[model samples]
Target: MAKIVIREELKPKRVIALMSGTSCDSIDAGLCDVFPDLSCKLISGINYEYPEHIKSKIFQIFSGDATIKDICQINFAIGQCFSDACKVLISEFGKPDFISSHGQTIYHYPFDERIDNISLKSTLQIGESAVIAENTGCDVISNFREADIAAGGQGAPLVCFADEKWFHNKNIAIQNIGGMSNVTVVSDSCETFGFDTGPGNVLIDYCMQKFFNKPYDRDGKIGFSGKICDSFLDCLMQDEYYYKNPPKTTGREYFTKQYIENALKFAPQNPEDIIATLTALTAKTIASAYERFVYPNVGINEVVVGGGGAYNPFLMKLLRTYIPKHIELKKHEDYGISSNFKEVMAFAVLGYCTYYNIPNNLPSCTGAKHRVVLGKITKHV
Candidate 1:
């Protein structure tokens, strides 16, 4: 261990942010120049595929088939994967001031489930920061969720902080459709807030792999070919998660393989229809969330779609169909943001705040009692 000095002067810092969303698709690494004012510009990025063996173990954990030893070993394994991803960027862009790693979330239990009379609300993101630091030779800031949860927050939808920084004063909703969809409502009238809107590509991706033997619904072609089963969509919309109030969040923990299989019992005979209905469920839940939580509170002038879903024409079409026609629908690219690497860039900003000792979590969005700086710093020796 070494004494890590925090830069005292406010200036631009080049940071590389690494993350692998619940999709478990790839490790997304982005190089960004975070300015003193909190604005960040993406310099470069890469989607590094996980080694087949490592990826299988991750999926095993998701399926609840992995043991404690597997989880323990995979932490460093994934850290090495992250460090390798950073090396790719570092080789081309050079070493950044530091690296920001979101790691991979193995389990996120945000509920206040009481056990032995003690409320348990916790999250685990596993790429060991020390491993990342040692491998990259750069100070690393990781585990961005723990502090927020400790502060009585759900420990998610952290992008809202960056959304507020970038889209404030404008009545807009930044809807990110990733493994799971979430939205941040930035308005001229009220404090910025956001919540998980429901399934994004999670169910659809699962069904694609299970039935079609594909990784995902690329460009949503399969989804486009099928008709949405309204009856099934109705059933999915009834989920309690959809009805829950804001400052809420969810992930693979709730939408597990068992949950999907159970829902499939009521699904249409046609697998494509099942995919279509799941896709529609995503669009409908997002629109429903807006209708229930957002529209009544603040007027939105635009809705910006980002993440992997932005590339899915079918999902985007459904979103456009369900969202109000009057409100403009745009992608992150339209605003000069990289749709694939937006979250990567976001973590860069979060890490910048951490390095500067600035509070990064949006209490209004995450339901923390107050503002607290997120992330733990691991200094490179």
Candidate 2:
């Protein structure tokens, strides 16, 4: 690979952050100009959809039966996709200082499971950073959750560190509804923490693919068309994870096709009802998280929403209905950030922190033993 060198400057150089969440939908990437003051500018961003066959392979692994050979190979394939995303961004925005990738989260364990009398806790984020480094010829930082998990955390809600920077000097909840929903509560002191609230767009998108042969319920229209089945909604809400305390994380392993299959036994027969109920579940659980964990302590003034859920008019409407009127709810766009790009942008900042040896993981949010710099760097040379 021919490398293009960026001249070092006093200001933090531009960086490219690439991400593919558990949703397995598309690669979201951003070009950000990070500053020493900790503020950042999103110069540009793009969403690269995976080819049908590649997406099929992703779902294949999500089924949990893929052999090690499949995982080993697909990891590289996904890396190439990530690299391609960076290439596109570079072609448009020029070479960045480095690259940060929140690779595909194949699995994220919420709690320790015992085996051989030892608590086994782990998480996997494929798409090798070495591949990104080699392909982009820039330093690549990735595998952000491993260190936190090793330190006895749920290995999640890492964005809390960046959320602090995003809304400094405010008592706010930055709720991102990606494959899963998580809330980062930042106090006026700039002290920040968060955890997985509950399911987000992942469940709704899975239902869309399963029932309507669509990637997602565009604008949550299918969900809007159906009535929320109260009984079924209650049953779905019964999941203990929703009620669990903070420092928790989950993935498709806990809420996926098999999950829906089990729920179908008691769910209303109408697919749209099931979809609507799931949407309500997301809205309700997110609000419940804030009401239970956030509002009591900080009395939040704003709930800035981001990610795919922000685009779902019905999901936003349901969230609005559930949230208290005392707090203002706004989309990321209102703050001049693209809903889909915030997480990717955040990772770019994380990568910058890691490079400077700054501690990036927030112990309060991830339950880590202490603050530590997150992500491993792979050098191109």
What TM-score does model 2 achieve against the real structure?
0.95
Q: lDDT per residue, candidate 1, 13-63, as tens digits?
A: 999999999999999999999999889999998999999999999999999
- TM-score for each candidate, following the candidate numbering: 0.97, 0.95
Whole-model lDDT, model 2: 0.86
lDDT of each: 0.94, 0.86
TM-score of 1: 0.97
lDDT for 291 (candidate 2): 78
Q: Candidate 2: where are CA atoms >4 Å away?
A: 1-10
Q: What are the per-residue Cα lDDT tens digits for candidate 2 across 231-259?
A: 99899888998877777877888887888
Worst 10 residues of 2 by lDDT: 1-10
Which candidate ranks first by lDDT, i.e. highest?
A: 1
